[model samples]
Target chain A: MDDLRGGCTLELGSMTSALKAQKILGTAAIPATVVKTSASGGGRGCRYGLRFSCSQMANVRMILANENIRVREAEWKDGS
Target chain B: MEGRELTYLDNAATTFPKPRRVIERMNDLMQNSGGNPGRSSHVLAIKASETVFECREELSDFFGAAGPEQVCFSLNATSSLNFCIKGLLHRGDHVLISDMEHNAVLRPVYRLWRDGVIDYSVFPTFVLEDDGRKTKIIHGILSKLRRNTRMIICSGASNLCSMTMPLAEIGELCRREGILFVVDGAQCAGHIPISLEEMKIDALCIPSHKGLLGPQGCGAAILGKGVMPKTLIEGGNGINSLEADTSGELPERYEAGTLPTPAIAGLCEGVRTVRALGIERIAEHERELFRRALIGLSQIEGVKVYCPHHEGSVLLFNKDGIDSEELCLALSERGICTRGGYHCSALGHKTLGTTNGGALRVSFGVYNSSYDVDKLCEALREI
Candidate 1:
């Protein structure tokens, strides 16, 4: 997921769930590469984006949506 | 402490009117051996180096570290924490931190989290009260750790308000879980008794200028053998300058460049002062001041004190209609040096439900007396 659109980063509870999200999206198992930036431009809330798989994207979006994040296009240099 | 022209109450920030001996020793060092310690082979350099070693020895004994070499000096708590946390943690590692943490811990962790370097989790230690006093327990923090939780960085005492963590319990849990534990003792070093062995702490970061009553710009991290971090700052360690690259070893591994010899010399004196006065005595003295402030704060009609049920100088509150800043200004106008706002502990304030504007924080030190606390009470009453 390159562009998280209106989606925000969810505070997932455990490492297993976070790892599962990565596996589902086929993204890096760690969220370290993702950059967090607030849409407000005032730097308050946070959103994330990176490259991943369909299952991973769906699971991450579902988790984000659960946390009130609205999914958008995965922001990447090349849309695979 | 009473009837003084200026009453200082921001010891949680940085203590003032350092012990006379601390100042005297620093002055003596500056006058006599102004040599670069751990560098030259001259007697003056050796003497200066000896001062560093002796101070480390005293600090090791003070904190119950395994040896003097385990104590590594840094510029301040922030620097020490950077050495302890960032140096040890790698990408994908999971870290658990308490809700009550200063920016020294929060900034580093947040930066890493934002950079996508590690998985971050916060364990709540909040204890809610009817009167707006939020308390937290250490057990709440320990119970939430998962198998992936690799490290735990905690504040020994809340900076926003004085709430001492169940350090022993948390340390034990970390040991049991095989998690690295780092304690930011900025507020507890000289004001409280911290035994590394008794606490089973992996690392203890302390600010020399705060509780230790040393000059500004001096802090240290006491590392246990179990905890070793990759170097954050690497350069000549002064011990092995003949080598092209820096050596990797205790104390030398973390410290780089020229040493803050003067500040450290002052810290040596500060440690001696703490030894002479005894940290237990200091704790007892601060408790008296805290008790007075708590009693007076309780009497105030619209004030709410935020600290643990135990004794300490962390006096946190918000008045009926006054903002934390306004109250702090009001107290300052009365010649009381108290800290307002989040105290660089935004996470702490958030967990305590005072994140909007934070709370007015008044921390005490050994130099503080019952009279200084009384003055704070009087000011709060007027507000």
Candidate 2:
């Protein structure tokens, strides 16, 4: 697993949307990887999100929005 | 007989020997992507969600739904019927149903009528001539239509008798009269080809576990344009969490809580298999089996077979002086499986004139062969 520190993670509502976002971002040449949402980060049940470089974060969000995929939230992890 | 291979003839209840790919896909999903679909974002969750989406797309294409989003998954055909019937009907609304409807459609309507929520009437059973069955049935249905009629709910094919309903004609009638047409496709979805748009069906409820050759615990309802049913269950749809009401999206509005992702995955593969095999080919095979069974059973003395003239793969009959339940037990002892009794379709029994004693139902599927039919006839003869 690549260290996603300093990258922006786009939390999606469902796994289907997350995969769609990943596919769209990949097609757009924006590198992104789907990872499990942290248990404590949300609540119960499995969740997924896409992690991408902070430089392409705005572009990724815009593309997902264009596709009508809902983004639950986005969190930026700070490097320790 | 105890050691002989068991012959399964109760395909109407649920299909056995599901396509190999369906089983494999379900197992793979369970092993690799057993996550709650549509509830979160993660690798496994995304895979699970994609599986569900693929299923919806396959079902939408197969059923001629407007889009994948218009297909909503449920527990079974009964659940889908409940969602459609209970969601769409209001107080004093009139519904027209066929005399051959299974309990899945009849019971819900009866309950609603009992509670003063809706009213419904059963179409009279018309005597079928060689070439006028469809016309007579259509006339019977049209005559029962009242001014307050809001919708028409019927089965694609009768589960008890294998008699297929005239869905296209009924759909046209509903369209011209501005009445909604809802079809319960529990016995016919994968066995017969249906074009939801071409047929003008407003809503179609299907069970994947039956002719679709999928595992149990998963079904779907396809909604046409401008057909919106009230939400049957209110819970988390993973959208609009801040608000109190459920999401108003096509499927999300109807689907609440975690979906059966693994089952949906299996259903996708099942639909794929059906497409590959082609529904026409499957129907031809089952028709042949039904023909053979009818011939074999009709030859036996004291056996009165009902619904022998239908084109579908179901056959209903009873032996003289033999109770249906006792006949079923005898067949079971001889390593044969056949469904006997009311078959959860009291109205169908009445339509077939078998209300005094429920008939024995032998339904053929893709896996059935002439050998199974021969074995069944032999068992019947012995009894």
Index of the highest-lDDT prediction: 2
Error of 1 at B127 (Å): 3.8
Per-residue lDDT tens digits for candidate 2, residues A1-80, read 45556787777764446666777898998878776664423444344578888888779878988888778764665342
Off by over 4 Å in 1: A1-80, B1-4, B129-143, B242-244
lDDT of 1 by residue, B220-282 (tens): 999996577888887866433444555534676677777788899888888888888988888
Q: What lDDT score belongs to each candidate, Candidate 1 first? A: 0.73, 0.84
Tell me chain A's TM-score in each of the predictions: 0.31, 0.79
lDDT of 2 by residue, B1-383 (tens): 43236798888999887888999998988887697777655566656777888888899999998767678899999999999999999888999998888899999999999998888998854523446778887888888889999999989888887678788998999999999999999998998889889999999999889999999999998999779999999998765565677754577768888888888888899899889988999999999998888889889999988867786778888999999989999999988888989999988888778888798988888888999999999989998
Model 1 residue B39 CA deviation in Å: 0.8
DockQ for each model: 0.01, 0.19
Q: For model 1, report the TM-score of its A chain.
A: 0.31
